[model samples]
Each structure stands twice: as C-alpha cells, then as structure tokens.
Target: MPRFALLLAAGLLACAAQAQATSFVMTTDALAGASVGVSESTSDLSSSFGDDKIVLAARDDAASFVASDGAIRGARLEAALRHIRERAPQLDADDRQLARAILVL
Candidate 1:
C-alpha cells in the first residue's frame, strides 16, 4: 500500500509539472500572436474603412450608436448604408458587421 501511494503521488506531480509547462508555452504563444494581430488588424481596418467617405462620415455616429445601451438607433446605420449604396454600391456588408467595422475604425 505504501509503495502504491508513493507511485501515485509521483504520477500526480509529473502530471502537474507537465500541465504547468504546457500552459506556459500556450500563454507565451497566445501573447505573441495577440501582439502581432493588434497591429495587423489596425492596418487592415484602416485600409478597409479609413479611406471611405461614407464610412468616415459615419464614424462618429457609429461611435455614438454603439455607446448607447441596448435598443439600436437605426437612423445613423441607415444613413451610412444609404450613402454606401448610392456611392459604392458594389460593397456588400450587413448592418451588424458594418457597425462593428465602424467601431473598430
């Protein structure tokens, strides 16, 4: 019984050590990827939304729209969509996605 208990404890310690090592590696990799993603996403968002007149016009309104609690105010969204449809009708996007992109910009 004593020998069995000793082996079990040894096994548990080894597993715990392995878990800690694995978590450290995962955390390190996640941090590295997140840092790289931040810059890339910013640049991507800029290229996608920054140059657009309609999106630029809607940035402040979108910021305000998101700042408001639940119950979306669609006026700003509609206005932006209208402008997009009138000017660059080729671009396709849904309201939620456009709102998110506006927030990101």
Candidate 2:
C-alpha cells in the first residue's frame, strides 16, 4: 500500500541521517603519560599488606576464623588486624573487610 511504502521510506531516511550525523575521532592524547616501561605483577596479593606480613602470613588462620561465625572465635583475624594496625596504621579497614580480602586474595 502507498501508506506503508511512505512510512518505510521515511524510516530509512531517518536512520541514514542519524548514521551520517555520528562521527568518531581517534587520538593518542590520553596515552601521552602512559608508560609501559615497568609493569608490576598483581599475582602476589601479600604485597598489598606492605610490611604487615602477619596479615598475609595468617591468611590460612584467618580463613578458619572466618569459617567460625561464633562470637568467641576469630582470634586469628584479630591477631592479623592488630599486626596490620601496628605496622601500617594508615590503612582504614576492619576485621570483616580483612576476612573477605583474606578469603579472596
């Protein structure tokens, strides 16, 4: 029908106009400060703890402590938190966060 034909033609023209209105420009300006000279590996999760090696060392114990949800448990996690606070006092984290991080990392 003539009406359907007219609608199809208008839709096609609108789509074509939209396609032409869009433009893409590629540039290397963002990579100006990027340096691939030295890249650090992230495989070592213990490095995130810095000098607070106890946190990394007690990961297994922390995992066990986390498994026990009782209030009287979590001695290992507490010890790790104390070590982290003593060595790296600047870190802003709690036992729950440390437990999660220990499980994942």
What would the TM-scores of all predictions be?
Answer: 0.41, 0.41
Q: How would you encode candidate 2's per-residue C-alpha lDDT over 1-105 as one tens digit per residue? A: 999999999999999877665522112433332211111211222466644556666677766765765243355667876866676565555555555455555
Give per-candidate clash totals. Answer: 0, 0
In order, the Cα lDDT scores of the candidates are 0.66, 0.56
lDDT of 2 at 98: 57
RMSD of each: 6.1, 10.5
Error of 2 at 75 (Å): 4.8
CA deviation > 4 Å runs, candidate 1? 1-54, 64-70
lDDT, residue 12, candidate 2 = 100
Error of 1 at 2 (Å): 7.4
Candidate 2 deviant stretches above 4 angstroms: 1-47, 50-53, 70-75
